[model samples]
Target: MLKKQFKTTRVFRFKRFARKSYSVFNSLHKTVTIGVLSGCALISAHATTVEPAERVYTQTSTDSIPPTELDEVVVTASKVDLPLNLAAKQVTVISRQEIERAPVRSIEDLLNYVAGVDILQRGPHGVQADISLRGGSFDQTAILLNGVNLTNPHTGHYSFDIPINLSDIERIEIVQGPSSLVFGASAFSGGVNIITRKDPESNGFAKLEGGMYGLFGAEARGAYKTENSLHSLSAGYKHSDGYIANSDYNIVNLLWQSRFDINGSNLDVMAGLNDKKQGANTFYSAAHPNQFDDTQGIFASIRGETGGRLKFIPHIYWSRHYDEFQLYRDGTPDIPATYKGHNYHRSDVFGMNLNMQYASRWGITSFGGEFRNEGIMSNVLGKPMDDTIGKYTKSDSRTNISYFLEHNFIFNRFTLSVGGLLNYNTAVVDKFNLYPALNASYRPSKSLKLYASWNKATRMPTFTDLYYTTSTHTGNSNLEAETSEAFETGLKYIHPVIKGSIAAFYMKGRNMIDWVKTSSDALWESRNHTKINTKGLDATLGLDLKEWFGANQPFHSFSMGFMVLDQNMVESGLISNYVLNPLHYKFTAALHHDVLKNLSLSWNFRWQEREGSYVQYVDSQPGERVDFTPFSLLDVKASYRFPHVDLFVNANNIFNTTHVDFGNIPQPGFWLSGGASIRF
Candidate 1:
């Protein structure tokens, strides 16, 4: 009888959502027609002002022998900088050129195509998303902006609330595998660092865009540069009525960055803010459909460095986050006015770091220490109290101090690094802990390199994981810290026309954390599970078509990547909630071609398959477990460049495939967007 009811519920849910999605798509079709017409009119008006330039390519002579070349990329995964081929860890770098060419609206969209990264997006244009790496949970991945850690202590879900506009980024660096030795905690899987543009060049751009679902946005950036000083400012705003009800959003971002050379020291300062308000249809609970959220974040950092054989860098950073959540847009009469079933949370983090590096004939040595404090004030997520003041219930704070040391030995053709970190946390039962790492790289030839690494890392529970409580969910403050040991090895090849890498990794986790429920009707409870094991493989291949075919080919570039992951639970009698989110396999491919002297076309494709199924509960009914079938998506972009302006159009999910990423939340299809940018 229960099985029959579950099946009936699943069918009804699928049909209901599917019908709504089709309606949204039909509305988008009309919007797309109007947007295209407007875009064409704007382009025609500007067509007489500028002339298109011929496409140019640098040609290399095949008749002459090329000189030996070392890798030009400087990797920052280690505390110190090293060449890409010489760095022991696996690193992927996305340059500004690539970012500009991709048909993506957000950083999360760009990362979704990477080999080992997993992006679970709940909304469009990075309104909300969760990022994971190598089968690790979202909380295990550390996020950094210009080397400043930005992992939120409140929840990892907000890690994507970055302030800098995509246009302001110079490059993105992804370091895969454990990195606790350098970054301390919450880097059990790896780290992602967004490096902002700091080149001393006087340049800027203004952009305007419109798309389906009432999406519209404007962005502007300006930079002033001199021989010894540089300053940059950027601002952007985006609004969308959404493809469906209760999914609309508006976002605003502002940033300022500056650098100055004072005597012999280099000083840098940065400040940014991001504000967002959105309707959350099924973001948290499906039972309450009229959910809404408003969030704001402010971040600032100052850093200075002095150079010598013995160099020193000192930096300090501060971040504040405010969040307000409403389960229902309208209040219920039964609920108390004092509580109102609304949640308000504020979190602040401040930290200071001092790092010293010494370079000798033998090798390079690096040492660093950090002190950080995190505090939170909440209305409904902490301890309950009788004397409530203005909807305030609880406040909590914690401090952490950490120190690390690393030494790199550079041989004629090999490099080896050893590092360790000691950390103390005031909130943890075991206040003191140590993590260590060892990595090695061997370069037999300029075109080929091999690397291997082993590391141990740990992560502390977030405030939401330790103290959050609600009618449908609960947290446990007694949960222990999660730890993991990871091992990885890879081979890389680089040539004039071809570049690629393949890596395999395994991780063993102890005291793994997860949210679980005993039955469909039970409330979700956070706990530290006994054990988990994960293994994965990542591979990427790229080809410069023009170079590969002797510079005469019409096509410019082609690239593809593939990843496979497997995870297992070693403990008995345990049910997992988030642990089963990893994909079984993922594949991505892209191609670019020049269609005319000033016109180009780019296309990207992705295929993904999840490991298993997820069970979603409907009010009072036995939930049905449904599997996310294999799905494929395709995106295409076309751009025309003129003397002073560039115009582009992007079509995403061109095939309009119906798919669900999480639960019954239907993803948008057949999205069309167009934009123009003017540079000075």
Candidate 2:
């Protein structure tokens, strides 16, 4: 219930500041009342208690709370804001009703049940998606939206190709490991945060969806409240016409959020706009069936926040992208100068973030700081190529600074935390970096917890990895700055009919930024020599069984999820034996039942497997080939509920399989969908 109304307003402001510090320490004498009774026994021993099946399913446990249940997540990987089981790392809370019951559209379908994630989809709906975590690379997994920093000043090659459409998410907190210490240094191979959807106080909603291969969509959200203020607005639109052969798409989004309250201090504002019209297959094959290319983009963002325990946030942004292309060699179009070309990209971002927390009598301390500035520009138009031409503009600027500190020692059943992070970066022409990190945590009980961390991160080599095209083999202006150091450990668990987590990780990278193919032609360039070693293990499991089938009103539920991953790069000349480096295994199962009682039942099953071959490019004659194969997939869904209205159905790759999550393009066979939702 609004997280127990924000935990009873932070325990009534910590019991009115421990009764005004024990009445000014008993009028300045009486030995300061034993330091105000040890700050009132550490705020009543960090109060938090509410069992009895969450106080008897306070407000219905809808389907046993397993829609990727995230019991109120808010973990900044220990820069404070705890919860997610006292965050000390290993946080995974993907929700928005599990992105609408896995209707995940993009962001690799919302990290397919995240557990050491690794996704690489080659085609279908505006193709191009390469996401990796624990197996880092997809530009070393460090993406954020809502915390802004969608990385890609061009050529970090991770632009899941537009469409963040997941119906304006309201959650997605994945802090697996090496968060580059409080988000910096490009996460080094971990950290994904995107929590949007705020400003809701009253009640308002809107939704519309269309399906099938050429899916269509619409959404509208509203919220308003007074007594101080709170407002919300959301908008969405989507289009697609792809299932293969040069995919297609169009997307638009607009969101606004606001909050205001005085006397307890609170202020928030957020704005957004994103527009895109995309269709590019990077020239698909089977003899290029009318291969076509196009791209258009526009973006905007503004944010501000300030409330309580030392807080402040500021942000600004702007973006523009446009591209027009045609290159038909076999599919005819009679090469009119290779069908003409044009490209333009622009960007600007400004930032500020700060937060603080403090609690006394020997524990709880947090600190923060952040500053950023970035600008980019790229422009190109028409002919001029024998090897390459000109008019390609470039402007680069960068600035970022960070500082952090943390502490959270609580005894009596464990609770210890320590942290550090300091980063400073500047670029306008390379060289100016300083990074650092350290972490720890341990909680012997309270549903178990244990953690560890070590960090050092950096990634800076974009501008098309130093000035775009310089033919014969792309540009590489003496790149350097892809550094890393990672170390990790994990374990988490909670109970009440089952909740879970399991983890293990290791990462080591150094100047490891690859893409090198040069022996006179085959053109591919971007380097930092290379050295990468990653290890992984992730686990998640859930079950409720409707409290042992004794259900009358706790809905009914069943769940299962599993994942495995292994990645490598032992650094033995030229990016050691690449395999697109992602050893994978995934499985999922879910069942929610009611059958009839307002009528609702849902079933979802997914399985994915791959064990080798994922290297996209590599050939200095020492190999002479490229690869991508080994695949398997499946998906399905169903829903229903009525009182106002709610009905749904879905099936994807349901037996009409035709797999290939990447390479050899083919996926999106057997597609069916139905939708309905109306509530007032």
Candidate 3:
């Protein structure tokens, strides 16, 4: 009955809009009349149509008579594919169309508008950033490329150093709660999975862009497909002169993917490389103004899957990363007592994963196991020794194994899922651990659903947390694993013209990790907090005016999202570095419209209020605590389409707002870029 109400309401709304629009578009009299007649007929036809077995939502395009319903499937929430409406956890899907329409140049900018996601950047154009979810630390989140883990073991700061360019991505799936039951330890807070395109049609594109601060870049992508095989390649290069002294950067990325279908089986292969060299002005220490860094990442993977009632997927992946950092510029003279040396670090991760799924009369069951080996070779980390000159020559390696199982039970309108993970690590004091989760969803009606989940997760300390040492920082190797218990509940409503959801969650953390210091002059030390608690609320609403008011309307779509978070440390009198960087409130709004038949415009806005204070340092003066101020940014994009080419221009931070996402790091201001893409 609820589903019928939704359909009727949408039809009535569309009828009202159609009748009122006849007078507005008198210039195109014949076109307007035909549109109204067709809209009414479609509404009548939709009213008489029968409900299908599976739920589907038709996404209205700018130039379509009747919307076509599509099955929205998701795979990250569980190990197996399920419709978004049936998923037990909160999931956000950013489709390829949405990605291409936005004026974002990097994955970081693309995720900035999502509710409950915080992207704290230290430089422009995604030079570096820390991704946090729901008040969790950066290390708690996991990053994946096509279901293969890409998390760096050395530090979470490099977790977003993905090798794929924007043109290579098909979609991004964000799981917004504890996902260790499906992924592994790094997924303690949440996870992000980027899916690449594998279309069977041959296509290619080339784009060139240049803008403020001497920013310029070029990117190209091409794909070839045959009946039995598909291949794709993408490459990009970007560079920028410094907005200020020693703030310049050069970035390069390359990716290749291939898939082959043979004998009722599918095999996929992927290889990628990312290299970046940038000026890091006061990135790590305020005392250093001419810092430099060069980083490179290489990743490769092979995956094979067999199709049947009983399915199996086997995968293996390898990742290698190299980092070189200089605290001072090359021309700077090394003083006797100053630390002016270059640090070189290398890390590698090799992993194997096997997944299986079975469909039976009772329910769908899935299970998986993973084996991983990771190691780091650094010039200045690990156990200190008398023979070594302030550098550890030996590599530090660790081995870990994890197995997970999940069972989904569907009966009538209710679905229940229970899962658990058993993990073992050779480096931990307790080498074995167990995590459990339970989720339930109730579809009161086809258009509305309610769900709740509870899960437990744990995270191991990173290499930086265990062995890093510097004049102003120190790390302890005796830290315990951070653990948390999370609970979440949400309600979702879906309709032809409108969709929305509201969710509330609470997390309790024990032995939470943070870098802290008691005094301004003391060295920051990595330690574990006794207790921490966080609670938050997230809400999102979207409206499709094109479907309701006809595509000729000036305003076609609008969406808004908001989040509120409150975090507290139960322990008394502790100053932290990363844990205290949560935002108190964040709000995002977006609007899209067609100004003309061939031209379109879109605008996005974000306002954020962050909690806590950071230490601000002046020249030869004592550091002072400065409360982070609230800031708002507006970004606008305009595009004009031709027969085979599309031209676009974007203005970012149009108001030239002066803001700092991190301590003493200034963000770009009033930047503009224009580009054109030609498709073949």
Each candidate's TM vs. the true structure? 0.87, 0.30, 0.88
Give every collision pair in model 3. none
lDDT of 2 by residue, 1-680 (tens): 76774344342222222122233323234323322322221110010111111111112122111112223444455554544554556677676776666644455655754545666665543245666666656666666665555555554343443334565566777765566555656666776767665534325555676787678766667778888877777777777787654566676766666655543334445556656554445332222344454544444444433233233333344444444443342455555564344445554545554444454444456666566555555553112233331434545667666666666664434445666556666752444445555555665765677777666676666555665563323556667767767777777777767777776667777776665543323455666756666666667777676776566764566666666766565533332212244646676666666666666555666676754332242221223334444444456566677666677777666777666654344556777766775655
Runs of candidate 1 exceeding 4 Å displacement: 1-70, 330-339, 384-390, 571-575, 617-622
Model 1 — which ten-residue stretch has the worst lDDT?
43-52
Candidate 2 Cα errors over 4 Å, as ranges: 1-76, 79-84, 88-90, 93-107, 110-173, 176-180, 185-190, 193-244, 248-405, 408-422, 428-493, 498-543, 550-602, 605-680
True lDDT of residue 457, candidate 2: 71
lDDT of 1: 0.75
In candidate 3, position 58 carries an lDDT of 36
Ranking by TM-score: 3, 1, 2
Per-residue lDDT of candidate 3, residues 556-647 (tens digit): 78889999999986643555678877888999998988889889888989999988777788972448877899999999889999988989
Q: Candidates' lDDT values, in order?
A: 0.75, 0.54, 0.76
**Using lDDT as the measure, which candidate wins?**
3
lDDT of 1 by residue, 284-367 (tens): 766666678899999987766544445456677889998998887654345445545678898898887766666554567888
Per-candidate total of colliding backbone pairs: 0, 0, 0
